[model samples]
Target: MQQHINEKIEQFFRDYEKRFRDGLAGNVDTASITSAFADCFIEASPLGVHCGKNDAAFREAIPKGYDFYKGIGTTKMTIGHVTITALDDLHYMALVHWQSYYTKKDQTEVTIEFDVTYFLQHRNEELKIFAYITGDEQKVLQERGLVS
Candidate 1:
């Protein structure tokens, strides 16, 4: 049972990573990424916490995030590490380390690593993220002068 659960969680994350990478590359629509989250989800970041619903406005707002990354010359995003903790039969926690590659205007390549902890719940026979806490990614980008 343990091994089976591990395999399921690993596969889930792999799919999640693929969606994120494709979304950043503009290969897929926002729905491809928002599909990973529940109808209502909480996002906690350096800016603040926001409880959002999966509405048309939310979908429209999703692309702006990708645009910001692209504006900063972010070329790729990859999963570096993932730690999955089974909270219960219906809940799971994932601590994910992500590496984002960027190119400065001067042609300098940069890789920024950050961690995000996500709380997922099994709903309707599938896992969906309900809440997530992110590290100070914007600060890191600003410190590196990737954004002002």
Candidate 2:
């Protein structure tokens, strides 16, 4: 049963990623993305410090210079893997790694690979991200001299 729930949660994240990418590309309605995340609180690290208090707080805590409603313009999000550890019936933690390509309005493309940790909770049978941290892979690679 726990495994089933974990799979469902993983699927939810995958679907959410697809919707988010579509929204960023301006190929899908923004509301669809927002609606998909409505029931869950999202507390993004390095910003959105207090956003998990409630939905309204989350909306107001949008990172400076970022418009959640406007959505990011990402061309692709290729998730390499997602590993979920169930804390209990309603709580879980997951580690995800992915490569993202972002397209600017002028058509310039930037690629980034990141590893993220997600703390999730189930509310009303829907999975929501309660906390998350995104790590910069390029910085790590540079520090290790893997990239110049």
Candidate 3:
């Protein structure tokens, strides 16, 4: 039963990622992008020292910082792996491995890889992300070099 629920959550995240990428590419509507981000939170730094505890905080902070993708340029995100751990019948945690290429307003492109963990809870039968921790893989690579 837990496995089945986890699979469903994984599917939801897959669809969410696709919608986010399409929106960033201008192939999908902004509403979809925002909706996908609903109930989600992200840590402010790679160390996990600071974090966004809820959706409202994420929404407020994103517009001021990372929301640059909305107007500044395009971004393509590809998720490689996702691991889900069940906390209970109504809660779960997921670790996602992903890479993204961002095209800045000046048309300059940069690619980076990162890992993020999301905490999700079932609300009204809907899986809603409640918290997230983001890490910077490039910085880690620079400090420790590549590792297989």
Which wins on TM-score, candidate 1 or candidate 3?
A: 1
The segments of candidate 1 whose C-alpha lies over 4 angstroms from its true place after superposition are none
Ranking of all candidate structures by their lDDT, best first = 1, 3, 2
Clash count of each predicted structure: 0, 0, 0
- Model 3 Cα shift for residue 29 (angstroms): 4.4
Per-model CA lDDT versus the true structure: 0.84, 0.64, 0.65
lDDT of 2 at 124: 83
TM-score, cand. 2: 0.65
At residue 42, candidate 3 shows an lDDT of: 53
In angstroms, the error of model 1 at 59 is 0.8
TM-score of each: 0.91, 0.65, 0.65
Candidate 1, residues 53-90, lDDT tens digits: the string is: 98898888888877888889998888887898989888
**Best TM-score goes to which candidate?**
1
Instruction: Show the lowest summed lDDT stretch of 10 residues, model 2.
Output: 62-71
